[model samples]
Target: MIIYQSGLITLDYDPATDILFINWPDVQDFLVPEIRQALLILVDHIKSYDIKNLLIDSSRASLDIPGTEYKEVIKEFGHNLMQTRLEKMARILTPNSTRENKVEEARQELRFPIPLRTFTDSKEAYSWLKGTLAEPA
Candidate 1:
């Protein structure tokens, strides 16, 4: 079921898998503040629904912010996410994009607080969230 829908994002919950799926709007079309607001809304649903697994499909998104500013915002989001009930998160990135490697690197680095991973395939992400895919060793 869709829990929230806005110009910046759309959130759907799958009770069967206990996962929340987020479809982020194209980052080139919106400012960071707008995206941040949508993310805050997502956190609210995550807390309210006790979401354990999250899948973010950002295959069409890309940030245009400076490196320093991007890092700052990511840090803030990380702090907020650590306070949630999330155990794992899978993000689907644009395949073959220039930023894919960078995003994957960030994913690996941020895997401490939660088991976060990046994928270029949505089916892979969904399978991982549904516990059908074997966890990496």
Candidate 2:
């Protein structure tokens, strides 16, 4: 069910899978503070529901926040997630090398305890999240 909907993002929860799905808005550029605010909302749901998985469909959005600001957002989000039951997160992204690289960099900087993966295909992303595909060794 959709728990939150805004111009910048939409959040849905799947009780059976204990996963939270986030649909981010299509934007060429976005503000870091606004993204952080949205992430905080997500944190609330994660904590409230004891969500263990997250699937973020970002194929329609391209975050244009500065590198440092982006890192800060990731760091803050990671810290918040650490307090929850989050065990894995999968992101669906458009096929852009720059964006992919930035995502990887952000993931590394966040250093989240949970496993995180990015995919170009929604099916593949869900498969990984559902444990249908084996995790990388």
Candidate 3:
């Protein structure tokens, strides 16, 4: 019973939580054209929604595959910040990485205009996005 709406792409909108779950199912490797289109779609969606915060659940996505420009995709979205009111963003990463400093790494790597955090749990992410805790500069 996911209430989904279509703009340039498909999105599951949770009005109760003000959460938008983007489903870019066609975002696989070897599809540069679609990837570019998806990025544009994402930008348009954010602009339309005037979204200020997001919890991007990319854990289910395999972006590390060959021919997939993960960084490029991220950069495109990250760079589109000025036009959108996006203030906070968080990603749910898999537990595979030995790297323990993912939060800091994500903040630095993403190059967003506002705060970005990576979490192992979605609840933590939700809390953090709701400003339950003061952000550290």
- Indicate which candidate wins on TM-score: 2
Off by over 4 Å in 1: 95-111
Candidate that beats the other on lDDT, 1 or 2, i.e. the better one = 2
Q: For model 1, how does the per-residue alpha-carbon lDDT over 41-88 read when each residue is reduced to its tens digit?
A: 888889999999999887877778665565556656666788898998
Q: In angstroms, what RMSD does candidate 2 have relative to the true structure? A: 2.0
Ranking by TM-score: 2, 1, 3
TM-score of each: 0.85, 0.85, 0.68
The clash count of every prediction, one per candidate, is 0, 0, 0
**CA RMSD (A), model 1:** 2.4
Distance from true location, Cα of 57 in model 3, Å: 0.4
Candidates in order: C-alpha RMSD to true structure: 2.4, 2.0, 4.5
lDDT of each: 0.78, 0.80, 0.59
**CA displacement after TM-score superposition, residue 43 of candidate 3 (Å):** 1.7
- Which segments of model 3 are wrong by more than 4 Å? 1-9, 15-17, 23-26, 64-68, 95-110, 133-137
Instruction: Report the C-alpha lDDT of model 2 over 62-132, residue by residue, as the tens digit.
Output: 66766566566777887888888898999887566666666677667767678888888888888898999
